[model samples]
Target: MSVDTAAIRRIAKLARIHVEEEALPGLAAEFNGILQWIEQLQQVDTSGVEPMAGGGATALRWRADEVTDGAQAERVLANAPEREGEYFSVPKVVE
Candidate 1:
């Protein structure tokens, strides 16, 4: 893949990066080198390689799924200036 200065300019615009006009040629050449390296990587043989998880062969530990309330509502509502039943109450500011 050939990366010309015009393509580099377009890429910079899309990525919201500021590139000096004189630096476009250098950036284009760098991008072309990267694309060529990626193309080379695509030609490698991976048919015999097995997919592996990032955590390796070990099974991950998992905790039991349980449901229960935190049961601290009274403690949480202790600092309220005004509360109606179980909720905080605020002055009405609109009709």
Candidate 2:
């Protein structure tokens, strides 16, 4: 399948991409190459293939569900030039 200049212009307008008149031919050629690749992929035979949820069938490993404050308050506040007790102090900008 070949993409014409008009179709390229319409695709560019829909995607909000700026395609100049000189660059439209090159862009259309690239789009035609992509469509040709898709056409070739459509010719592949997959009669007995089983579709999985994702690319692989490996189960995801999960850690224990625990919630905490991350235990790095002092380490995190060490880089603050101005801090108040355990938090960074910022200058009042709004009344």
Best by TM-score: 2
The positional error of residue 50 in candidate 1, measured at the CA in angstroms, is 0.6
**Prediction-by-prediction clash tally:** 0, 0
Best by lDDT: 2
Clashing pairs in 2: none
Which digits, one per residue and each the tens of the lDDT, describe model 2 over residues 6-89?
999999999999889999999989999999999999999977876665555767889989998789999999999999999999
Which residue ranges in model 1 land beyond 4 Å of their true spot? 54-62, 67-95
Locate the minimum summed-lDDT window of 10 residues in model 1.
49-58
TM-score (C-alpha) between model 2 and the true structure = 0.66
Over 1-95, each residue of candidate 1 has an lDDT whose tens digit, in order, gives 79899999998999999999999999988999999999999999988786686644768789888886568778877999988877889999999
Task: After the best TM-score superposition of candidate 2, give how far the Cα of residue 90 lies from its true spot, in angstroms.
Answer: 1.0
